[model samples]
Target: MNYEHVREVDPAVADALEGEVQRQNDTLAMIASENHVSEAVLEAQGSALTNKYAEGYPGERYYAGCEYADEVEELAIERAKELWGAEHVNVQPHSGTQANQGVYYAMLEPGDKILSLDLNHGGHLSHGHPANFTGQLYEVEQYEVDAETGYIDYDDLRDHAEAFEPDIIVSGYSAYPREVDFEAIQAAADAVDAYHLADIAHITGLVAAGVHANPVGTADFVTGSTHKTIRAGRGGIIMCDEAYADDIDPAVFPGGQGGPLMHNIAGKAVGFKEALEPQFEAYAEQTIENAKALGDQLQERGFSLVSGGTDNHLVLVDLRESHPDTTGKDAEEALEDVGVVLNANTVPGETRSPFNPSGIRAGTPALTTRGFDEGACREVADIIADVIDDYDDADVKAEAAERVQNLTDAHPLYE
Candidate 1:
């Protein structure tokens, strides 16, 4: 992965690029939204298509010399349809937030009501955080997970929907660690004659592999990030039935963005093709198994996990109850010092601020990609427990760092 030409032109940027490669190879990536893409995906994303400007959908571009761009975009759309079984797919939203924006721009009017889960309860900013455009433009209301069980309060959601009469009811999550009941949310949306937008941004690969319940057929609009569990390059996708296809296409292109990132679309096509293979299903299943193992070990170490455990690729640990003195940021910094990478996250019924929350989130997609299994993940959990138990102890961090090096050595990446 030497950036020979890049070094000749821009040595500083090349150094940073190589440093990132080394960083990924040396550290554990437990960030829930991150994954290591295949070399094929990497190659496609770095291809010459990045220079092209394909302003419209396949075969209907606004510019000439778009034959190859059209081919890549069409392949991405077709492969996405096959992977997710959607009647229509838009692969040009740039990111999951943009994908959500497409749905809002297409169907929602200014000041329209939006009912979604609370961010501290596992919802995304695109759903309706005050800092995001969705919150500023729409009349937003939020629902919560059960504080006791750490699961979605579907009955409460339904009750809220009936009262709020939102234009759209959003399902799916970012930090929650359980299987979502899409049907229940759909019913809530139906009861109020509102649209359902299920943003499966975190579990796109699981849904594609049938490990998680798919919302494509249940929700009116389904959106996801291509990179999370899908092992695609960084991009967003929107899927829908034929009824809203026309609206979504323009909403993503002319309405939201100028020209599509055709290189990323090519990467998506390649990654989707890779995901269609039988091995990807096993990978998805193993990702869940690894997360369960990681969470169980954390629990046995006297840590508290949201929803008790995970049904997907990530686990959410609430440090407030388990380690009263420690914050998520404290644990996150200590873990990173030991080469274990994750993030500080907000748990349901959060008491602390979002920046320094009470919970830590971890996932196994990147670990599983590096060929880590349940036992390896459990060992990683033990290291995490040690760090969190004694974050200020240099000796403890040193020992954990040695173990992390051994783990990374055993599962080399980008070789």
Candidate 2:
């Protein structure tokens, strides 16, 4: 695979790369929005196409000598449309936030009202966090999850839509664990005469594999990251009904971004091809199983889970009930010390600031891709609980680190 070729000229950079691989092999990756791509995807991303700068859509580029780039981009767009069953697709935006911005530019004017989920309550920053461009440009109204159930309350969302009279209703989240009822959200938007945009970035693979509800067909516009569960290169895609294709394309191109990353487009094409394989469906299903098993095991070990449990590939662990004195920051550090990687997140209604929240978010997609099953997940949860239980004691941390090393040795990722 020539993976070691980089070491020949720059041993320092090569050592860093090797060290990263070793870290991945030694740690349990549980970040919900992260996954490792296949070698083929990696190869495409690092291919010669990166040298090109085809500034426009396929066959209509601003620059000449883009025949190969045109072919690769066309393949990516076509494969993405077919995989998601969307009427039109634009595989250009550099990331999910950028994709959301493109959608906004396509459909609404600056200062238009947007009703979206609240950030601390599982919503993505692009959905309207005060710090993001979405919030700065748009008049944003945020809806929160029901405090008791930790689930979206459609009635409350409807109330917000009615009061805000928003031009767009955004349905999607970054940390939520339950299945999003797009139909309900759409209906609410319909009642308010607002456009519905579903940002299914985290669950795109499950939707493509038919393991989760497909929002592309129902939403007026659907935006997602190609990486996450889709296993594509790090990029974003915006799909919509054919009626808005022209507007979306222009918004993504000259309106918001310049030339597309042709190499990443090629990698996205490879990812779409992989998603079309029947085995992808099995992998998607197993991801959910592993997540549910992990959630149940953690709950059994006295860790409180938001939304009771997960119906998707990720879970939000509310750390307040489990470790009374330890915050999500403490848990994150302790887990890292034990060679398990996860992110601290804010639970719905959490009082802590975003920098140090009350929850930890974890997922099973990467681990399942590395061949772990439900039993393995159970063991992982037990270890996680043990680490959290003794986060302050140095001896406990050392013992947990040894156990993590043993688990990683047994699993042996990227082999």
Candidate 2 Cα errors over 4 Å, as ranges: 1-5
lDDT of 1 by residue, 108-205 (tens): 99999999999999999999999999999999999999989998888999999999999999998999899999999999999999999999999999
List residue ranges in candidate 1 displaced over 4 A: none
Q: Each model's TM-score, in the order given?
A: 0.99, 0.97
Residue 270 CA error for candidate 1 (Å)? 0.6
Clashing pairs in 2: none
Which residue pairs show collisions in model 1? none
